[model samples]
Target: MRRLMQIACAVAAWASLSLPLSAAPTEPENCPGLIASRDALVSRAALRQDEVGLTFVGHATFLIETPQGVRIATDYSDGTRPPVPPDVATMNKAHSTHFSYRPDPGIKHVLKGWNPAGGPAYHDLTVQDVRIRNVSTNIRSSGGGTEYDGNSIFVFETSQLCIAHLGHLHHTLAPEHLKKLGRIDVLLVPVDGGYTLETFDMMEVLRSINASLMIPMHFFGPSTLNRFLSSAREHFPVEFSNTAAITLSRAALPKSPKILVLPGH
Candidate 1:
């Protein structure tokens, strides 16, 4: 009986030693639980199965071309119009430049980030190879008061990659917001510093999101852009691109978080 008891104790100790020291959960490969409901009427072959093309069309607008040729314009407005009409156009009502009353009629979907009826705007739809959703946040009114659920952070899921566009964001993200936004592979962030969140606060927001790749937008000029970049370099490596467009893939994402500065605002 004593010999049997010693053997049992040794086995238990060995099993405990074999267990991993830290059982921290691994990061998700893609945004889970975000499923696209609608199917696209048309499918145009353009990019590879795992590729997404992004063009910095100026301001908060980025032309996102999916693998199935679904074109999407972020912060779509008259000033930041893409050369080619997009299939889906997302707009925010923070200012006249962010939203348009009359978007091109050719656009199949016009998603507004705010509801004129005075509540949160909700959107969840899929077009071609992409699933689009929005998580609403608040904004500051002209009178310096809070406008609850006035802004949106649009998330685009396609090619196993999750990309988020932070539109005229006025504050940092909450825990609930992070839960809704799943795993973001790429982030389109506004670096105007004053117009959105201040540079430091915006950096905090970026850290909270922790996207592998971050693209800066909505900057007024080089001064504002440089100011943000100067501070950002301390935290993450910065890459300056000569062109305004770049193609991204999930498998090719940087191992370490990086800030990619594309030409144009």
Candidate 2:
């Protein structure tokens, strides 16, 4: 009975969230960080759209390919590079492994999550057919103190899918953070219980976001990944993919939230 009540509340919360755009979503300079409802978004059960490809490039890096061919690499660093140079790359300053001091000059856009002087880093832009933006979040500094706006939750909107990557998140999200994220159909999250949010807190985040698909990243090994999967299975269906990449479309998203564990290269 308790589990049923929890699920019921989750469903009610999901219904209350504002849906994405109905027509081809506009490319705004910044994500409004608010939800808006329209005839199209309300009337359509599924937005028929082209597929977006996501390839896990190891560690926290994932290469996202839009239907129009724009490619974005998340948490880009020197440790791993996409087979092809990404048109845009978003990096977080959580650690050396998450950002590169010397990025390839050929890349057109390099977005860092933190400002060198310590203010929040902000990015809201459109490249080709995809819209990219970020919400600033704090991280634990190497000195064991809180670093304000040291990380970012980057969102990519394309093919009618709102995909967010939570970069090296250290704490549970605040109400303001949830408002800024709007509706996330897909979420790329760090699952290392110690390095990122602890297992229970991470589950809370998953429940709060209520994303259609949850992809686990940044786990050190199978043991850590397995722990997350076991805990998450209670609320969300889990799927294991042999390959590192998956193609998704808004129309094909699972009705209930699902966790997809993609093999890292």
Candidate 3:
């Protein structure tokens, strides 16, 4: 009986060693250093918790209002101004229409996407109720050569959501860029087939980011917007909103990825 028990124990040990090791559980992707607790968020006004308001202000600009009443304007330019001065304004120099030489004096923070000193523009700061950061990308120069670090992809973190604005993105993202961006809940992309990336390449960018919601911007007109929508519909459902603004929350995000077109330029 003792010898039989020893043989059984040896067999069990061999089987355990022969079996393949179980794979480690995968961790969910998230934006680093952006998550904030409810206690950390300051309630400044009537906006509900975990809610953000976004309004298209024509062209590539959009006005973002946080639950804490913090206001931000993207691609801020003289032509596309918000109803009032924003608390913070983010600008890109891809075109004069995407940036302003002189922003409103009342604006508290003016973040330029490109460095005039000839390097990548860097911005990582926290305002009243949100944290804003940037990942630099290249743009096409006048001579048609690669302009390294000429553009930036600005990200806003608030109300438990990460929103990214792809400013004149000229190319598909690399793995490193995706790593830095982490998990984006909403993506504001430029869909002009000519000025920015072509339709197919822009689609590739959309796929790589894989945000829960996508808002198209920078299209010249209906023809341009239609061209992008037709291509985008093949991969994701497209929804048209009659209103120019929308409120979003983490709990209300679409179950599947979707493209939401707001009525604006």
lDDT of 3 by residue, 1-265 (tens): 4533343343332111100111111322444211111111112343476677777888999888897798999999989878788899999887999899889999999999999999999887889768888889999999999999989999888778888999888999999788778788889999999899999999999999888889999998999999999999999988766556666677666677888887778
| lDDT for residue 108 in candidate 2, whole number 0-100 | 96
Estimate the TM-score of every prediction.
0.84, 0.82, 0.84
Clashes of each: 0, 0, 0
What ranges in model 2 sit over 4 Å off?
1-49
lDDT of each: 0.77, 0.75, 0.78
Q: In candidate 1, residue 88 scores what lDDT?
A: 97
- List residue ranges in candidate 1 displaced over 4 A: 1-46
**Model 3 spans with C-alpha error above 4 angstroms:** 1-46
Better of 2 and 3 by lDDT: 3
The digit string of per-residue lDDT tens for model 1 on 140-206 reads 9999999998899998888777889999999999887887777888899999999889999999998
Question: How do the residues 1-265 of candidate 2 rate in per-residue lDDT, one tens digit apiece?
Answer: 4533343343332222112432322333222111111111111111123556677888899888765677789999998767677899999988888998877788899999888886898887789767788889999988999999999999988777788999999988898888777788889989989988999999999999999889899998899899988999999888765446556666667787888787762
Model 2's alpha-carbon lDDT is: 0.75
RMSD of each: 15.5, 10.6, 16.8
